[model samples]
Every structure is written in structure tokens, then in C-alpha cells.
Target: MDLLDDDELERSAVVANCRMNRERGLLGSNGYDRELGFNPLDVLRKPSGESRPAGWLDLCCGSGKALIEAARIVHDEGMDVEIVGVDLAGLFRRVDPDQDRLRLVEASLGDWRPDRGFDLISCVHGLHYVGDKLALIARAASWLTEDGLFVASLDLHNLKIADASPLGRRIAAALRRAGLEYDRRRRLVSCRGRKAVDLPYRYLGADDRAGPNYTGQPAVDSYYADA
Candidate 1:
């Protein structure tokens, strides 16, 4: 359901929930847990010929506390890594304006594109407010280096076409064909390799009047024209 415009967002609510999301144990890389099967250090271990520093990128990063904590841990352990967090929120907490490693950006994910590739990228529960989730996923996948991970939490039922027809099954099949894995139980979509993908539908804009989503939070609904 749509309760926010593309240019306007529920930043305060999202930032507030970010703390809850972390407490609920949804922030995968928090304080580095190997049991979670996610290790940001692994991104550094992977061989890379690129000149840019190996790093992590977070979409809708909110207060960016997770990344900040990660930087502190890496610093204490003497690891070299940078973090870039992008969110539409006007201001973020726990942000050191002068901090060099963890960079926080304020902008819509739809318009914010990084100039470099990343080894690990995540969007924890950020898709709930996106108008074109599929479009973002496709672009996000392209921003990863080979073996780089692109993980995003997505709700299948939250997506629909212009006519309000549920395309959950059809979209899941499309993701598989595109080399991405959709975990139905977790409501997550992830992939390791980057490949050009073409979906069977064309974006027909979005509806910001739909209402709240399964999480009881304001969300954007995308409408794609059937191919």
C-alpha cells in the first residue's frame, strides 16, 4: 500500500525501525557473525585487481550504525575497508561528519548510483518503500563485482502489475532465470554473479496511494505493464 510519494519518505519511522530491525536480528553483518553465513571480511579476502578499496555498500542505510560498528571492529583488527551508506533520510544519527571510512549519503536509491563496484551490498528491509523494487534489484546486481554479494529483503506479494494482478510466482521464476535466488520463506532475493538481465515486463510507473505493507509500514507499489 502506498502512503508516501517517491520524493517523500518516512525517514523517521524507518530510522526508528532500523534499531528494531537490528534488535530483531535482521541486520546480517552486525558485529561480524560467521554463524549468519555472512562475513564482510570475506569481501576483502577475495582477489581483486580494481584500484578502488574493497568495501560494503548499504542501501537505505538509515542511521548507518551497523556500518559504523563494522568500521570500528575492522579498525581494532587492523583491516582496510570502506563503507558507503545511501538513504533518502535528511539526517542520520551516529554519523561522524568527519569520518573518512564510513560515508553516509542522503538521496533516493532510485537516483543514487555509485561510481564504483562493491564486494558486498545489502538492503535490509529497504525495499518496502521502493516504488520500483525490480528495477532497483536489477541495477543493484549490476553494481557488484564477480563473486560480490547482492542481498535484499523483498516481499513477493508486495509487488504487482498496473492492473493490481499479483505477479509473485511469475517474478520468482524471472529471478531464477536471471541467476538470482529468491528465498520465499525469508522474503529475500540474493545473487553472487553479475549478468545482464531482461524481465518480461516493462515498468509502468508506481502508485503511492496503495497503503501499508505486511510490516504495517508505509510502502510503495510498483506497476509494470505486461509483456
Candidate 2:
């Protein structure tokens, strides 16, 4: 429907609405109500053997699910970790007020500047909505400490243009205008480095498992760069 044709502000609003609707549906349906389901704590725990008390940032942390998960990981590991959740929408209100461990900030990722770099920065299911993928990655890279981790998850389903669908072609053209490119075969791609990485995709819903409705092999790619 060329939601972004109006303006950047309108585009952000459209993306935000899509995210809110999908999140409400998913949570209401109990589609991910299991213990730590869809949370990154379980994923982060695997490689962080005995890593103590590190700072974590959850960029575009919608509804603060990942922020809560990061908080749990810090508490359980007894690590002196501080968790920060930032998003364009005020979705942080959905988080419990009693959880002092998590701090939520209402700001676009492009405008936010943290005082200190984090040990780990996560952009789960939020990278695709950004207007400038490379610039965002560079900004994210700037906010990382040495050897800090940056985890991003992008959906491939919305990155393609089908001849049969006018909407799809419009989306593809918009992405081209933005100078972004994506591969649809890989469902999810993760980039970690001190320098900016070029990763691309389309704006799906706020959840990793939502939108584009295409199923493919999930992939995670990691890289190390000096700060």
C-alpha cells in the first residue's frame, strides 16, 4: 500500500501500528507465553560462559520483552548488568513498573546516544523498520565497548518484489530508493563487530516470527572487529 509514500513520520507510524497490532495478537493468543519463549536470555546464555556483570542494550525493544529477559539473565547470573530498552513508540509502558532493573527510553534509534557503550546490544526484529540500515548499523556499532556483541534479527519475507503483486513491487522500489538490499533465502542474519555492517531487509511486524509469512532456514552470522 506504499505506506511510506507520505513521509518518514508517517512511515514510522505505520511501522509502529503494525508492531503494536502484532504484539497484542501474539500475546493475547498466548502464542509465546511459555517460560522465556521468544526471549534472548536463553540464546545469550549459551555463549556467555562465566561472563560477569555486563551492560546490555535492547534497541527498539517493543513491549520490553527482551529487556525483561536481559534483566532476568543479569539477575540470575549475578552479573552487574544494566539493561536499557529504547524504541520509537512508547511501548515500554507495557512493562511492569516494579521492575527497576530495566530502564526504558522513548526515542528513535537514530536520535539516541548512550553515555557509555554496552557489552551487548540487541536489535531483535526491529532493524527492518529503520529507514537507513547502514547508518543505523554504524550508530549501533559506535555504542559498543570492545568486543561487545550486537545481535540483530531481520525477516526476509518482506524484502522481495513479486511480479504478481503491485504492493510488493512498490515496497521493493521504496527499498531501492533507500539504497537497501536484502536476501530472502536467509530468514535471519546476525552481525557482530566493532565496525558497522551492512544488513538489509523490509519492515515487518515487531516480533521475529511475524510478518512476510515466509518460512526458510534461520541463520546467524557473527563477525569480530576491533573497536
Candidate 3:
């Protein structure tokens, strides 16, 4: 089947209404904190009295509850930090309308780009919806500051070429060559520094027909144009 275009996917009401349904702490039941092996707040925390502002960017941020919660924590700690979140979803609630440090944007991650780099960038359970996971990873890496960290949840099997053929090892090789680390067991991709890298495939679009991922919930499949 031909993959759905990015614009079409973005306009889908079903796709745009998704939410993370954040809890008080674990964000969701995904064990994200455990997989990360560190508290996100630690990375976001600035010295209690420092004036230097730190920033974080979260892509495919869903309802941006995690960013909002983080913003509240940092604010209560009296640290200067800025948190920006972007998602394709149509409606996202502002955790704190009074907090200027937090900005939740509703837009497609496929085309949206941050104006500045961030100390940390993350996409939690977001890659599944992307049509070009590798391209987006490369783009996210570029959005990170020097020595900054970029992390996302990814399933290698969800990637395919124009013919629905999996790139398999080629994807890992490209990511490593570009300085990103893919943890197959964790189903996570991470990088600590930014580098320019290109893959051999062109993104055709996404497949929403595929249903129920490992989490027993529906997710999108990414299709690429293979050479």
C-alpha cells in the first residue's frame, strides 16, 4: 500500500487528538524513567541561583504534560530554564498559562524546526508516528547543542522502504556512522553530540493502517523511498 502523505497524516482528526495522559511522575506507564536510567529533571536542573538559562526541546510532545511538569519543578526550584514542546496534535493543554518559560506548540514534527539549539532534546514514544524516522533523528541531532543529548523511542521493525522492505542493519550502521547509538534491547536511539548525516532512503510517508505495536496499542509505520 502507498504510504499516507505527511500533510494527510497531520490533518487526520484521529492522529491529531492523541494524548500522552501523563501521571504525577512516570509520565506514562512506558517505564521511560527506567529506560532513560536518569531523572530528566537532573538534566534540566540549573544551579539553584544561576542566572544562565537552560533549555529543553521535546518533539512529538503529545499534550506536553511532561514538559509542563518539568517547568513547574524548575520554577519551584528557582532555576532559570526554558522548555519548548512541539506536537502534531490539534489540542494541547497548557500546564501553566502563567509560566512564560513553557511554550507548547501544536505543529507537525516532520516540518517544524526549532530556532535555537537546546541542552536536551527528547521524543517519548513519538517516532512511531513519523514517516522518516532516520531523517527526523538526524534533524533532532542537529537541534542539540554541543555535548547535548537527544533521545527517542524507536522500533527498528517499524522502518521500511518504498516497497515495504526493511532497511535492517543499514539503519544502525548509518546511525553509528553519524554518531548516534541504537540500543536494540531498549528500543531506544540516543546521541550526545550533533553531526551531519544522511541516509540512503527517501521518506515516502507514514502508514496508519498498522495497528497495535509492542505496547498493544495502535501506532504508525514509517515508509521510505529506497534506492
Q: Highest TM-score among the candidates is held by which one?
A: 3
Give the lDDT of residue 206 in candidate 2.
Answer: 25
lDDT of 3 at 165: 77
Selected candidate, larger lDDT, 1 vs 2: 1
| Candidate 1 runs further than 4 Å off | 1-5, 8-52, 96-99
| Range of the 10 consecutive residues with the lowest summed lDDT in candidate 1 | 18-27
How many clashes would you count in candidate 3? 0
* Per-residue alpha-carbon lDDT of candidate 1 for residues 69-164, written as tens digits (9 for 90 to 100): 666656676566788888776356575544567788888787789988888888877787677788889999999877788888788877787678
Tens digit of lDDT per residue, candidate 3, span 144-210?
A: 8777789888888888767777765778887887778998887889999766767677777888877
- For residue 211, model 3's alpha carbon misses the true position, in angstroms, by 1.7
What are the lDDT figures for the candidates, one per model? 0.70, 0.50, 0.74
Candidate 2 least-lDDT 10 residues: 218-227
User: Candidate 2 — which residues are off by over 4 angstroms?
Assistant: 1-7, 10-13, 18-53, 93-98, 155-186, 196-227
TM-score of each: 0.80, 0.57, 0.88
Candidates, ranked, lDDT: 3, 1, 2
